[model samples]
Each structure stands twice: as structure tokens, then as C-alpha cells.
Target: MDIYQICPEFKKGQITLRQTETQDAEELLNCYSDEAAVPLFNSDNCHGDDFYYTTLERMKQAIDFWDFSYKNRYFVRWTIIINDTEEIIGTIEMFHRIAEDEFNHFGILRIDLQSRFEKQEIINDILEIVNENLYQAFEVNSILTKAIPLAGERIQSLLNNGYSPMNKRFMGYDDYYRRNRVDN
Candidate 1:
């Protein structure tokens, strides 16, 4: 049930994954509040200051969810870390686990290391997480990602890695969203 402690560190030559503790508040705040994180989480229902507060509130909610049911929400989230310096630069999470719903059996989410490593390594980590974790539990393994416009080559890299745009047309709701995310 303890996803953070359950998995061993992310074994690169020297990098790793360690459990995030309450002491990490300041560091996580700094990372999540960065300019790079804003676009990845599209401003869904607010603007300017409201959206900013909403973002922080959303993070609080996530942390709360993580603590809500340690067992099921074990898939909730984890702070990404580098083993050498013991610095937590970012995070990865399950994002959602629709237990009673049939649609999203095992959802995936991750946000980590804007500058720590090349985007390809992040993609590789994502693949590794999926292959080792989620794929072990679900029949279908998928991700819910936001197509941030300014990701530049990063977006192309994700596509190259077998990730596709889910609602490319965005004309109608397929039981997921309220607004039809038409690329108009």
C-alpha cells in the first residue's frame, strides 16, 4: 500500500527515489510554483491569482488524498529525488484510480525534473514506472496528459514515445470532460 516506500529508489548510476516527508514542503513549494509547471497544469477554472491559489489548493488536495487512504491512495503520489544530493526536484503520481468506474482502471501522472536531466530520460522513467508499476495491476495502461503548447520538441518526443493526443478533434465529450477541447 505504501507506493513511495514500496518501490526501491529509481536506480540510475547515482540517482534514486526516496519517500517524500513533511519536511519537503518548502522545496516542493518552490518546484511546483515554478513557471514551467503552470502550463503543464492548464488553468482549468480560474484566472490569474485565483488560478494560482487554485493550483496550490489542488496540491494540498493531492497531499490530502495521499494521506486519505494510505492503502488505496498508495498510488496517489511520490516526490521525485536525486540520490546523490538528496534533493527533491519534482513528483510523479497515479493522478487517478477509478476503482468503481470501468473507464480509468489505472491512471498515470508525473511531473519531475525540469532541468535535472534530458527529456528523454524523463520519458524513459515514465515508461519504466508504467511497465513496472501500473501495468502490473491493469489490463490497459494509459496516461492523461495535458498537451502544453510551449513544450516544443518535448511534445514531439512524447509522441515519438508512443503517446498520442487523446482528444485531438475535441468536438464532443466522451464522458471525460465538460468542455469540448476543440483546437480552435
Candidate 2:
């Protein structure tokens, strides 16, 4: 799929995944500011951004950067919303990695969620949608994400969804996982 031409939306059960918008700044601020959630975010190779936006202005700035990234085809970021509450829970980012390392041409996925919603079930639900769609969206053979040992829920959800811990360091970073697409 040519994600640069059009971003797709995915919906199943109580979860909705759609391209992020400027108006999401206010609701997204809560997830970015959550002290407990900050540590769980995957900020690898982000040039030192920890994804902690404590204020509305900072959140807006981050959202602006996401927009710029999407426009430039640097990556695509989708906001995660819970249908029942209409609350913005987090975001999912995916990009086609271009590198000389073993991960070349792979899809890099980054999922950031509020600590309260970090349960294995909720994460499984979120990953279900992404796992079904992102491989084609990013046109990659496999997808990778980060999950530290401390992130038990995330690790379990990933394992349940066909992901396994990657033994090699990802561009000098550790605690990464990989899941290859199985051809039908």
C-alpha cells in the first residue's frame, strides 16, 4: 500500500486506529504526561526525545512534528482511541526502516499507551489490529517493536501475537522484538 498517498483507519470492537489530527493535542497530553507511561515509551533513535510532554504546548509541538513526519513520508503515526469513552489512549507509529544493519527494509513499530491501559488484554487488542494491517501498509517482510523486561504486559501480548525477542541489538539498542509475516 502507498501509505504516503493515503492513511487508512482500522476499527474492531472498542478500539479505533486513525491518522492523528492537530486537535488530539489536548487528549494526547494526558498520555504523554503520565509519569508511569513515560518509561514504557519506545524512544529509541529519536534523537533524545523521551515522549514526555507535560504541557499542552509541548504536546501540540509533538503533534506538529508527527504531521511533518507523515507529510515527508518519514513515518506514519496513528492515534489510538477507545470507542466507548471516545478517549485518546495512545498512539502507534510505523515506518519502513532503511539501514545497513540486519533490520534493513523492516517495519519499525512504536506503540505508546497510558499506564492504566497497559494490561495484556488491552495491549493484545491493540496489537491485533496492527499485526493484521501494518506489514502491508509499510510493505515490509517483518515488523519490530521494543519491550523492555519491565514491560511484562507488553512482552506477553507481543509473544501472544507471534512476536519473539530479538537477540541482536537494533542499531546499538537492546530489548527489541521481531515478528515476521507468514505467507499464506
On lDDT, the candidate that comes out on top is 2
How much lDDT does each candidate structure score?
0.48, 0.91
Query: Which pairs clash (backbone N, Cα, C closer than 3 Å) in model 1?
Result: 10-17
The TM-score that candidate 1 achieves is 0.61
For model 1, the stretches where C-alpha displacement exceeds 4 angstroms are 1-9, 12-15, 42-65, 69-75, 99-102, 112-118, 137-140, 169-184
Cα displacement (angstroms), candidate 2, residue 30, comes to: 0.6
Q: What digit string (tens of lDDT, one per residue) describes model 2 on residues 1-184? A: 5988899988877789999999999999989999999899999989999999989999999999999999999999999999899899999899999998778999999999999989887788778887888888788989999999899999999999999999889888899999999765
Residue 96 displacement (Å), model 1 = 5.1
Backbone clashes in each candidate structure, one number apiece?
Answer: 1, 0
How many clashes show up in model 1? 1
TM-score of 2: 0.97
